[model samples]
Structure formats: structure tokens, C-alpha cells
Target: MIVFDKVTKHYGSHKALDDVSFSIRPREFVILVGPSGAGKTTLIKLLLCEEKPTFGRITIDDKDIHLLKDRYIPYYRRQIGVVFQDFKLLPNQTVAENVAFAMEVSGKPDNEITKEVMKILELVGLKDKASNFPRELSGGEIQRVAIARALVFQPKFLIADEPTGNLDPVTAWDITKLLLKINSLGTTVLLATHNREIVDNINKRVINMDKGRVVRDRRRGKYDYK
Candidate 1:
């Protein structure tokens, strides 16, 4: 469902991504694993259109991303969900409001918005915290809220960058299981993380990067840095 065709990105003279190419099929759970400065974040940013590729194409469900018009960006984004290292929850809004806000801005019907919000909250196991603000929740709970918001639209593809970075090992594993569950439900997941134990334990497909290129790609893999 997603393809990176010879994608390259450079920050001035320093290349952040160098001709990286890969394809992710529907429902595939793929992990992008690498040390810091390995261009994993660069890859995610390019997919999100937060950064344009210096060369090559990125296609999602066959549509070339860079070719899309500015007005239609949201339409494209609605097909994908993203979670970041920091749970980007609104401080003032309650959990339900945070999830509902995405639908609201997209002009969804009020009833539909309400339904989706409730459904996703339940999916992420945060239904009871709907009325609570971000500050009122624990790190894990806040992250769950972030996941719910990301899944509210039932996106075809999910991108998570360092999703378990701030949590304890046990909490990290819980979040990992959540991602696995989401993948099992047929949403493609692309995770960029440094958590070696989680990556090793999951035993999923791993794509290791170094400098700016994919150094290895393994299926049902262990953590083998060399």
C-alpha cells in the first residue's frame, strides 16, 4: 500500500536519506530500526509530507505524494495515521475532544464524529478517560489517547516514531502489543524505534538503516546490528 521509489533527501550538503526504496503491502507490520542519525525519522517525515524528497517518488495506494495539490493534502492524510515520540495531545481538551477534534476539522457529521471518537477510544482502551485532560493522565494513558486519535479515522497505514521511547519497558511492551493488535486488524504499521528488546521480541520484519540507506532487511528477525 506504500512505496518508496529511490527516495532521497538532503539537508544542504548532508544527505539524510540516500536513495531509499521499499514497499509495504496492506496489513504488513514493518519496523524501521536503526541507531540515531540513521535516517529513520527522515523517512517518516518524507512519508508525512512534512519534508519533500530531494529525489524520487513516494506513493501511497498508487498516488504520487509530491504531485498532490496543497488543498488535497488532508484527503491524502486521512488515509494514514501517525503517532510520535511525544504524545501530541492538547493540554486543555479532554481525551474525547482531542480525538473528536480531528474529525471535526475534517467536516465530518457530528454523529459520525461522536461514533468514531467513542469507538477509537474503546479500541485504544481509553473509553473511561474520555472526560480527562492530558495532564490528568499517566504517560501510558496519554499515549493511548494519542493512539486513539490516530486510529479514529481507521487509517489504512500507521506510522509510529519512537512510540515507546518515554515509557518503562513493561509499558513499552504494552504499547508494542497495541501496535501488533492494530496490525492484526489489517492496518499496515511502519514503526521507527530504538527499543531493541521490543523489536527483538516482536519478531516482525525489520529494515535496518545506516547513514542514509537501508543496510539490511529481514523477515521474522532478531536484533542483529552487524
Candidate 2:
């Protein structure tokens, strides 16, 4: 479980997040929706430990994340998988290598790395593109590779930030279905997106934010924004 206890973040004199509080239970799929500069990104940063909260506490699985030492931050981060709007892949590496690189950096054995890479590629429906490079694939395919890379470690939580922003509507829907599939298989998903169509269609838990504060939180909620 993830808990945010009155979390607040400040940048200079500006408050990016204002006493935000929420809890995400295990295996629950939740959407974080808000307009630009509404603190969505800041909240994610705090969760990832990229930035510390100026006030409040964040706990994951009962451990206070902010109290973790610098040496333990990397290990803490490995517990959550993150995907972004931009597909960040190595131009020089093939799809298989790109996925395997995550395990490689963590010093996993070659045999285990290969096995896990193949499994994750198959999970993301991109096993056939294993040998292909990023430049040879379409935008959707690139995002699939990114998702596979994020899942290679088999993290308990997945954070997707505008994952379908760069794709067409059809491709975006496909990606959304893929995320739903993953969530159904028991990975807790926190999707931060501005796409109302996806949010309303999914109809899961919705937490709406505005001006750095949570305005509404509902189960099976719709996107109530312009």
C-alpha cells in the first residue's frame, strides 16, 4: 500500500502540492487527473523520491520513503516501475537489449537477464520485434518497448505519465488495453494522464487535482473537467 499523509511540496515560494493526502491500496488501478501545473508531475516526483516533500510523510509498504538514505534510494526505486510520455530507448541497442539493459545495470546474470527480457517482451506483445531497433518501429511499438523495459524487473507498482500522448487515438487505445491487462494480472497501476477519453473509459478510481490540491476522489469516477 502507498500512503501520502498531508504531503506538501514547495518550490521557492510556490506550493506545487498542498497538503495532499491519499492512499492507494494494493492491486488497485487509479488515475491522477489535472490540468497543467496542477501538481500532477510534482506528486509523481515525490513518489519516485526524485524530490523530497517540504512537509508531510510518504510511506510505501509501511516504510517511510523520505527517511531512506541516499545509498538505499536506488533499491527503493526498484520497487516501482515508471514509464513516461517520451519513449526513452537507446538508439544503438535492439529491442531485446533495451529491455535487458535494466537488469544488466542491476547486475543480473546473463541467463536470467535473457529469460526475463524474453518474458517481458512477450508480455507487452512485442516478442517479434526483439531484434529490431527503436528507429525501425512505430511510435506505439517504441512505447511497448518502453513498457517492457519497465516491467522487466517485475515491480509491484507501475507509474505511467502521459504514456499515450505521442500516439494516435487507435494506438493509444491499444496501449490503454495493455495497461488494463497488466493491472488485471495484479500490478498496482497509477496512471497520470490528461486524456479524458481514456480516464472515463477505464472508469476506475479517479483522484482529481487542481491548484495543487485534491478536489475530488471517487471510485469508478469519470473525468469531470473541460
Candidate 3:
């Protein structure tokens, strides 16, 4: 379980998050909706332990992540996978190599890296593009490589911040479906998106934020918050 208890973050005098509280259960698919500067990215950053909250506690699986030692931060982060709007793939690396790079950096064995890279690529429907470079793939396929790279750790939580921001509607929905499939496989998904069509169409738990505060949270909901 992931719990955010009265979380608040301050950037100089600007509050990025204000007294936010929520809980995410394991294997749950949650959509985060908001306009610009709604604090969505800040929330993800807190979860990733990239930034510490000025107040409140963020506990994942019962551990207060902020209190973890610096040496342990890397290991703690391995438990969660993150994908961003910009599909950060090396232009020079092949799809398989891009995915394998994550493991390679972690000192994974050559055999294990090869095996897991193929497995995750297949899961993302990009196994056949293993030899293709990012420059050769479509926008959606490039995003798939990013997702595959993020999953190399087999993270329990997957935070997708604007994963569809770079795709057309049809392709965006396709990626959404892929995320849904991944959630069905038991990884908790937290998607932060601005696309109303996709958000309303999803019919999942929606957490709407504005001015750094949660304005609405609904179960089996849409982007209808006002």
C-alpha cells in the first residue's frame, strides 16, 4: 500500500503540494487529472524520493521512504517504475539494447540482461523491433521502449507522467490500453494525464488536483471535476 498523509511541499515560497492525502492500494489503476501546475509531477517526485515533502509522511509498503539512507534510495527506487512524457531513449541504442541498458547499469549478468530484455520487450509488444533503433521506430514504439526500460526492475508501482502527451489520439489510446494490460498483470499504475478524452474513457479511479491540492477523488470516475 502507498499512503500520503497530509503531504506538503515548499519550493521557496511557492507551495507545490498543500496538505495532500491519499492512499493507493496494490494493483490499482489510478488516473491523476489536472490542469497546468496542479502538482501532479510533484507528487510523483515525492513518491520517487527525488524530493522530500516539507511535512507529512509518504510510506510505501510501510516504509517511510524519505527517511531511507542515501545508499538505500537507489534500491528503494527500484521498486517503482517511472515513465515520462519525453520517451527518453538513446538514439544510438537498439530497442533491446535500450531496455538492456537499465539492467547493464545495475550490474546484471549478460545472460540475465538478455533474457529479461527480451521478456519485457515482448510484454510491450516490441519484441520484433528489438534490433530497431529509437530513430527508426514510431513515436508509440519509442514510448514502448521507454516503458520496457522502466520495467526492467519489475517494479511494483508504475508511474506514467504524461506518457501519451506525445502521441496522437489513436496512438495515445493504444498506449493507454497497453498500460491497462500492464495493470491487469498486477502492477499498480498511476497515470498523470491532461487528455480529457482518455481520462473520461478510462473509467478508473480519478484524482483531480488544482492549485497543489486534491479537488476531487472518485472511484470508477471520469474527468468531470469542476
Candidate 4:
């Protein structure tokens, strides 16, 4: 459902991505693995339309993303969800409110918003923390809240950038298991992470990028790439 055609990205004189090309089919769980400065974040920024490619094209469902109008970008993003390394939660908003905020901003009906927020909370195993603030939750719980918010819209594609960055190995596995579950339920998962153990344990599709190029692509493989 997603394709990158010889995509290249540059910042001033430095190249961040160099002719990177790949396609991710529907319901496929793909992991982007590489060391620092490997252009993983740049790839995501291009997908989110936060940055334009210096060359080549990015297409989603056959539509060229760069050609899309700015005003329609948000609408397009509704089909995709993004979770960052840092949980970008509203410190003052309750957990329920934070998840509900996305639907509310989209102009969804009040009843629909309520139902979706509740369902997503349950999906992320955070129903009991509905009224709690971010400060009251552990790192793992906070990441779960972020995942809940990302999944609230029932997005077709979920892109998580270092989702388990700050968690313990055990908690990281919990998060990866959740991502796998989401993938099994038909959402495409693209995880960008450097956690070797988690990536190896996943045994899913791994795309290793280095110096702006995809150095390795494997299906159901271990993380032995350097």
C-alpha cells in the first residue's frame, strides 16, 4: 500500500536519504533497523509529508503524496498514525481526554468520539487509567497512552519511531507484542527502532538502512546486520 520510488532527501549539502526505495504491502509488519543517522527519521518525515524529497516520489495507494495539497494533508494523515520516541501527551489533559482530543479535532460527533475513546482505551489496556494524568503513569503506561491515541482513529498504517526507546527490555517486549497484535488485526506496522533484541525477537520483515540506503531486507529473520 506504500511505495517509495528512488526517494532521495537532502538537507542543504548533506544527503539524508539516497535513492531509498521500498514498498510495504497491506497488513505487512515491517521493521526499519539501522544505527544512528541512518535516515530512518527522514524516511518517516517524507511519509508524513513533513518534508519533501529532494528527488523521486512517494506514493500511497497510487497517489503521489508530494502532489497533494497542504490543506488535504491532515485528511490523508487520518489513514496513517504516528507514535514518537517521546510520548507527546498533553500534560494537563486526562488520559481519556488526550485520546478523545484527536477525534474532537476531526469534528467527529460527540457520541462517536466518546465511543471511540472508550474503545481505544480498552484496546490499549488503559481503561482504568482514563482519568489519570500523564504524570501519574509509568513510562510504559505513558507509551501505551500514546499508542492508544495513535490507534484511536482506526488508521490503516501505524508508524512508530523508536516506540520503546526509553523502556526496560521487558516493557519493550510488551510494546512490541502489542504492535504485533495490531499488525495481526490488519493494520500495517512500520517500526523504526535500534533495539537489537526486540527486532531479532520479532522475526518479521526487517529493512536495514545505512547512509541513506537500504542495506538489507529480510523476512522472518534475525537482527545480525551491522
Candidate 3 residues lying further than 4 Å off, grouped into runs, are: none
Candidate 2's residue-wise lDDT over 1-226, tens digit each?
9999999999999999999999999999999999999999999999999999999999998988999999999987777888889988999999999999888889899999998898899988899999999999999999999988888888899999889999999999999899999899889999998899999998899999999999999999888999
**Candidate 4 residue 193 C-alpha distance from true site, Å:** 0.5
Collision count of model 1: 0
**For every candidate, C-alpha RMSD to the true structure in Å:** 1.1, 1.0, 1.3, 0.9
Per-residue error for 190 in candidate 2, Å, reads: 0.2
In candidate 1, position 217 carries an lDDT of 86
**TM-score of the candidate numbered 2?**
0.97
Going through the candidates in order, what is the number of backbone clashes in each?
A: 0, 0, 0, 0
CA lDDT of every candidate: 0.90, 0.92, 0.92, 0.92
Q: Which ten residues in a row have the lowest lDDT in candidate 1?
A: 217-226
Q: Give me candidate 1's TM-score against the actual structure.
A: 0.97
User: Model 2: how far is 143 from its true place, Å?
Assistant: 0.9
Candidate 1, residue 177: how far the Cα is off, in Å: 0.5
Report the lDDT tens digits of candidate 1 across residue range 120-209: 998888889899999999888888888888888888899999999999998888899999999999899999899989888888999999
State which candidate, 2 or 3, has the greater TM-score.
2
Measured against the true structure, the TM-scores of the candidates, in listed sequence, are 0.97, 0.97, 0.96, 0.97
Per-residue accuracy of model 3 over 45-142 as CA lDDT, tens digit each: 99888999999999988989999999998878777888989988888889999888878878889999999999999888999999998999999988
